[model samples]
Every structure is written in structure tokens, then in C-alpha cells.
Target: MPDTPPEFSESADSDAVAEDNEFDSLRGILADGVVGAAGGLVGTAMMTVVFLIAQSVGAFELTDFAILMELLGLSEVVPPVLFGFLLFLGGGMVPWPLLFASLKAYLPGESSPVSGAFFGAAMWSGFVLAFYTGQTGLSLVLYGILTLVAHVVYGIGLGAVFDYFETRPDSIV
Candidate 1:
């Protein structure tokens, strides 16, 4: 009786809506992952610089990268310093933001600077401190103080960058 078939029209409309929803979901995931990765990389970079500066200034004499490689018995390849930087980039820089993003839903407090600082402290105490202490026999008092400060700085940088990108008018996440 009508020019359009009823079944075909209904199915097509439903399909279009379904497709749109799927696309939106995928877009949200991509946006969040990209923004989080960017934030993590930047934060790690800042942390590395601060640590290096402190090391040069004779704050403490320990190399996390070297200790990690030695602990894993991988120090024979190239040099420990080179491998340490690579490990720091891959292990340290890449994971923080991703972990933060994954745990964003459960992270206490709003995603503000204070919250970021707290997150950084948690990360240092929970992960970094333990690792260094076990692997390198780090001085709990000295190394802990340095790492706590550095991790807090890193967290602040990560949070600031993520907030900036997330709040942009065209941000998709």
C-alpha cells in the first residue's frame, strides 16, 4: 500500500541507530586511550628530567635502570645506562597514565591537582618504592624522599595535561 516497505524501513532505521551507538562507544575509547597515553608520556618525561637533575646535583647515587637490569641479569646487552633509559621510557613513562585512566572510575576525589598528587604518592609508595628498595637496597629515608617528590611532580604533570586535553571544546573523551 505504501511506496516503502514497512519491514525494510524499520530495520534500516534501527540499524542506523545501532551503528551510531557502536561508533560513539569506539570513539570514546580511542579518545580516552590517546589522551591518557599523551599525558603519561609527558609526565614521565618531566619526572626523568627532575631525577637526572637531582642525580647530577649529588642528591643520591643510585641508578634504578641499572639495578633493574642487573636484577634481571640483562646487563650484558649493550650498556646498563642505555637499557635503563629505554626501560624507563617503556616501563615508567607508558604505564602511569594508562593505570590512572584504568583506575579513574575508582580514583578517590575529583581529577584535580590535589587528587593527582595523592595518586602520585600512592603510586610511589605502592609500586616504585617497593621495587627500588628490593632491587637496589635503596636507603628508605633518602631515596624515599627523592622518589616521593618526583612521583608527586609526575602525577601533577599527568593530571594537568589530561585535564587540559579533556576539557578542550573538541575533545572526544
Candidate 2:
């Protein structure tokens, strides 16, 4: 028999356990960022579906894409719609996810999805103000409702992706 009991021998101090956890390592942090980006991309796709449906019904326009094209002056270089979409996807896949990850701790929720939904709602307020299309009457109302729903859906998708990765036994996060 060993001198130390197996139970006590393998036990670690709280500090050691905390230090040894995945998030403390650089590799783990990078892994989490990649995972978060994937989640954000998924979320963006979900939001795009909502916008596409709205566009089909004439309730919405590709205002964001147009704005991006104008701001970047990429209209002459490439098709405004295509360039705008690529930019949008890039934005969704990186910065937004990074922001979400940074703020996840402060957002109120029992799970990532709930917190993400809150984050999306918060983001929508800014978007509504910044991207106002001068819509009025019922058009404005529909736009508001649809955009809000889309943002919430995006958050859910983002959070679901995080939740999925986190639940895996071999997850880096």
C-alpha cells in the first residue's frame, strides 16, 4: 500500500486548481475566442434569415449593406450588395463575438443564451438609433418589431453555440 491515501494524495489546493483550469492558459483563451467567433457567425446567419424574410415582404431594405458600401466607397470596386454582405459577415464573425465574450460576465442570465439575448437587445437599441431609415407609421412599427425579433434570435443562436461547445467533455472553454 502507498504511504498516502489515494483520495488525499491526488487532491489539489484551491489556488492550484484555479490556476490549472483551462481559461488561465493562452491556448485556452485562443480556443475560446475561436469558439466565440463561430457562435457569432451562427448568430449572424440567423439574423440574416429574418432580414431576408422582411425584405421579401417589402418591410425592410438592405440599409446596413448600403450604408457600409457608401461608407467604405467600395461601390465601384465590387458590387455594393456583395461587398456589404462580406463585410457584414466579417463583422459578425469577429468583433461582435469578442464584445459578447467580454461582456458575458456582466450580462444578467443563468446561461449564455439568456445573457446573449440581453446583449442583442441592448445592441438593437443602438442599431435602431444609428441606422434609422426615416421610416414612419406602420412601416416604422414593423421594422422595429422585426428587427428586435431578429436581434433576439441572433443572440439565441450565439448563446446556443457557446452552450454546445461548453458542454462537450473535451471542450477547451
Candidate 3:
């Protein structure tokens, strides 16, 4: 075995580094985008829920809620909790699963946390902003922080568990 050229080894190392960097950068972007969308969905759900409850209890003007709902082609009043959960699940888990699955195809060797932290954080961000829109409250900060953490944990945990299951010997992403 003749001595390998230094240039050959250096080039190979650079290629590996570049590849890793690209992979990380892509994952980061995907993670961020998924989180953002999830947050938005949660916020929207929260707002809609509030509107429904307000209408039912007369806390929010019926005319306004009705008009909004009618415009959206929704004719039914929905439970706030249902909306909240939908928003939470949609924001916290929807994107991650898709993102994780897509990433698996490209980066099967990459590490993705099972906890739903990513979506949680992102959804929480949107939730905070939406909740605080044109309003001030003492619990705003607390709710915001809690929302973020809850969503993130859910997202990360879900991811971890998902990955765990997917890691079975015969599993395929």
C-alpha cells in the first residue's frame, strides 16, 4: 500500500464536513418552519375557541362571532377545549411528524428528539402573541412560557417516541 496523497485525504475530509454542515443546516430550517406553522395553528385555534365561548356565554358579542363563523362557512359552535386541543396537537405534533418522516428519508443517521419540544416552542410563541393581541394580563407571561414549554415537550417527546418505534429492526420510515 503506497502512501496516500495528503491532498486526497484533505479533500475527503472537507467533503464530509460540508455534507454534515448541510445536513445540520437543513434540519435546523425544517425544524424552525415546522414550529412556526404549528404555533400559528395553535394561535388561530385559541382565538376561534375564545370567539365561540364568548358567543355562547355572551362574553363576546353574538353578532361578531356569528358573522365571523358564518363567513368562514362554519355553522356550529365548537367547544373551547376541542379547539384548544386541536390547536395544541396540530401545532405541536403535525409538522414534526411530517418533518421527521421527510428527514428520515434524507438523514436516517440524524438525531431527532422524541419529545414534542420543537412544535411546543413554536406553537407557544404563536399562542402568546395571539393571546396578548390587544390585551394585557398578569398571567400573559406565565401562559406564554407554559405554552411554549408544553408544546416543545410534547413535540420532542412525541418525536423521540416515534423515532423509538420507527427504530425497530424491521421498521421503515
Candidate 4:
């Protein structure tokens, strides 16, 4: 006996629900991407600090920035530290989070620290090993070890931050 048809009202309700669901899905994707990027930045920052400390203590004696500068033909134009910073931001901070977010499903241990550490090792194998193994000198071995440790630390930080943010719906909103 209502003025409105029952079919019209039912369809409207279903449409609203569908729209809400779509919005939620989009929001989730956005949250994941943003959180993952932030985590990567943090991890890279921590790695940088660790490397600096190692250098100061004479435990490590490699300059990846120097190598990078030479490779890019920027050795004459820019200092290694400056170039290194840019590389760290771009290479370590930007890509890692996105990579983690994309590969998280396939990574073992359900986003835990262990899984993150494993992911770090995977990254080392894929990126670090491929790039650094060809370099010459005793520093290479020391640098390689230091880089391995740093990458693992980075992974832990990346995973922890992502997981923390992922679990908190209110934080994303």
C-alpha cells in the first residue's frame, strides 16, 4: 500500500551497499600503499643510521654512494654522500614498501617479523647480491655482510609498521 514500489526501494538499498563496499575496497588499497611506503622509508632511515655507526666504529669501510656516483658518471659532479641519500630515498625507501605490499600475500608467516626478515633476505638475493658481488676488493665482503644485516633490519621495520597500520582501521581513515 506504500506509494513507492518495493522493487525500487530494494534496488536502491542494494546499490548503496555496493557503493559502500567499493569505497571500502578502494580505501583499503590506498591505506596499504601509503603505510607500506612509510614503513620502507623508516626502514631505510634505520639502515642508514646503522651504516653510519658502523663506518664511524671502523667496522665497515665501504661507500656504496661512491660506487653509485662512479657508475652514474656523477663522481665529478656530486659528492658520494649526497648521491647516496638520493639513492637511499629512491631505491630503499620508495620501492621496498610497494614491493612488500604487492608480495605480502606470497611471503611466508602472515606478515610477522619472521616473514619480513625472510623478505629482506629475498631482496638481498635479488638486488644486493646481483649488484655488489661483481665489485672488487676486501671491503666487498665486509660491505656485503653489513648490507645483509641492514636489509634484515629494514625488513623487520617495514613489516612491523605495515602490520601496525593495517590492523588499525581508524588510523587509515
Candidate 5:
């Protein structure tokens, strides 16, 4: 057999597991491109998915949770769900502006404040949702404070994600 160079010669995908685990691959690309973007989508969707499922199973009604029991089902959930949907839309849009702004600072491109603001808002929304979920001691002060810090971090994730791709051109989502 021409002295067979090696039986276990490593191949490009030799270590790849034999499963249709595309989600991880996609997530890795997305995270590398935008950490929060990928993480946010997965996290938020997971929560909302569970919530929606619970609604069908009457999970909201089963607990002593006031928000679900006391508040208007149609009204309360709708606003927040809509609010979250808007945030996700904004989430998708947040990073590019910061990326371009970075371009303005170092590279050559138009920097957009609107994009930055959207990015900030999306990040803030994550924190706000967290506080909103707590029924015992939900307060505006907590929401406001957390929102401010999270927004800044969200913007950074955008820039970092974009930059990561710059260095790793071989990467793809």
C-alpha cells in the first residue's frame, strides 16, 4: 500500500463530531461577528419560547405571579412582547453603526449616531427585561441604572464582533 504514510492522518474536519449540530457552528460565527447579537437572539428566544409554551399550558396562570395573574393578559403581555420584538429588530441593527463609527475613527466610513443609539437601546432592553421579570421588587431605579451600563457594553460587543471578522477573514456565519 505504498507504505501507507499514516492510518490516522489528521484531516481538516477529522475532529468534527458526527452530528448535525449546525446551531453551534452558526452561533460560533455569529458570536465571533457579534457576541451579544448571537447570545441575545438565543437567550431571548429561548425565554420567549418557553413563555409562549407556558401560555399554552397555562403556566402563567398556574403560579401566584401577579403580573400574569393580576395584569390584563392581552394588554400586559402584548406591550412587553411588542417592546421586546422592537428591541430584537433594533438588536439586529445596532452593531453596524458602531462598526462604521469605528471606521470613522480609524478606517474611512460614515459614523451613525442612530445606529449607536439603537445598539445602546437593545443592550439596555436586556437588562430592563431582567428587572421586569422580577415580581417581588421591580422598580424603575433598578431598570434605569442597569440599562445605562448594559447599553455601553452592547456597543462594544458590536465593535469587537466586527473586528474579529476583520482578522479572521476565513470565518463565516
Candidate 6:
């Protein structure tokens, strides 16, 4: 009151609040990215288990990397298996996770896991359409079933990770 007008003081206070809100928004974005990446790691690992089992049981021969290799035309230039796997892993950790985090709020489900499953299933449609493996008969059916199951497992794992982080006392988001 002595040094500054009331209006000026009010303006300063509002400015400070606005700055804090901006910071909080940025922080929330970072938190979502980090959490989503972590969830992706877990989700990818779970998906890999299903794939390995399915491969062993002769359900299908294609891995995530295999499809990626063909799609990217890297099979001839690089060691397809190793390079493709690395690419797949990197993709799982970043883009997919970020996308999942962005869409989580809008997805339908009673819980995080359920929502994640829906997300995975939705993603599956893309995979089936974009990366058709050309299987037929029993193998095709098994491939469809097994891949769907794998995706659901992946989503469950991802959502579980999100749930775990969200419930923590010092949760970022």
C-alpha cells in the first residue's frame, strides 16, 4: 500500500498464479511422457512373452521386429533381426507410450487396465490392416487370436503401470 498501488499488487499476484499454472501444465506433460514410456517398457515385455510362447507353439512366425523390418525395407541393408528388434523396442518405449498417455483420458473403461486394453485392441486393428501377414486357415485364425491376446496383455501391463504410478504418494501426474 505504501510503495505500490492495490491494482498493481493484484496484477502481480495474478501473474504469479498464471506462471505457476503454466509450470504445472508443463510438469504434467513431462510426467505423462515419462510414465507412459515406463508403461510401454512393461507392456512391450508382456507382449513379448505372449509372442515367444505363440512362436514356440507354432501359432505364427512373425515378431514385431519382423513386420517392422519388411515395412521399413531394412531387411536387406541391415541385419534384420537385430536391427529390427532395436527399432521395435525403441518405438515401444517412445511413440506408442506417448500416444497411449495422450489417449488414456478419452478411452472407455471402468479402470486404467480396461481402458488400456481398449487402446490395445484399437491399435490391433491398425496392425491387422497395415501389416497383414498373409496367413490362412488355422494359422491365420491362431495368429489373429494370439496377437489379440498379446495386445490385451500388453494393454493390461501398461495400465497396471499407470495405475501404480498414479496411486503413489509423490506421483508426478
Best by TM-score: 2
Q: Please, what are the lDDT tens digits per residue for candidate 4 over residues 1-173?
A: 46878766645677667656754797766865677778888788877776776566554544656666777788788887578568766776667778776787788886656677778877877546534635446566656776688778888888888778767756642
Separate clash counts for every candidate: 0, 0, 19, 0, 0, 0
Off by over 4 Å in 3: 1-96, 103-110, 114-116, 131-137
Q: Which model scores highest in lDDT?
A: 2
Candidate order (TM-score): 2, 6, 1, 4, 3, 5
For all predicted structures, in order, the TM-scores are 0.71, 0.83, 0.43, 0.70, 0.32, 0.79
Query: How far is 72's C-alpha from truth in model 5 (Å)?
Result: 19
Question: Per-residue lDDT for 8 in model 1?
Answer: 60
Name the regions of candidate 5 deviating beyond 4 angstroms: 1-83, 94-138, 169-173
Task: Report every candidate's CA lDDT.
Answer: 0.69, 0.83, 0.47, 0.70, 0.44, 0.79
lDDT of 6 by residue, 1-173 (tens): 56887667745677667655754797867877888888988998998888887777776564546667877887888877778778876887888777877888999997889998998888788766554567788877877888898888889889989889988866765
- TM-score, model 4 to reference: 0.70
User: What would the per-residue lDDT of candidate 3 be over residues 1-173, giving only the tens digit for each residue?
Assistant: 26878766644677667655754686655754554455344434444454454435433332322333343455366644445445434633455455544554444224555233444454456545544433235344444444455455544554555555446643222
Model 3: lDDT equals: 0.47
Residue 11, candidate 1: how far off, in angstroms?
Answer: 18
How does residue 45 of candidate 5 score in lDDT? 43
Model 5, span 45-85: residue lDDT tens? 44344344434543222132233323445435555545445
lDDT of 2 by residue, 1-173 (tens): 47987668766577657656757788898998899889989999999999888777666787567677878887878888778888888888888888888888899998999988998898889777766777788888888888888888888889889888989988867
**Residues forming the 10-long window of minimal summed lDDT in candidate 3:** 59-68
lDDT of 1: 0.69
lDDT of 1 at 109: 62
* Cand. 2 Cα-lDDT: 0.83
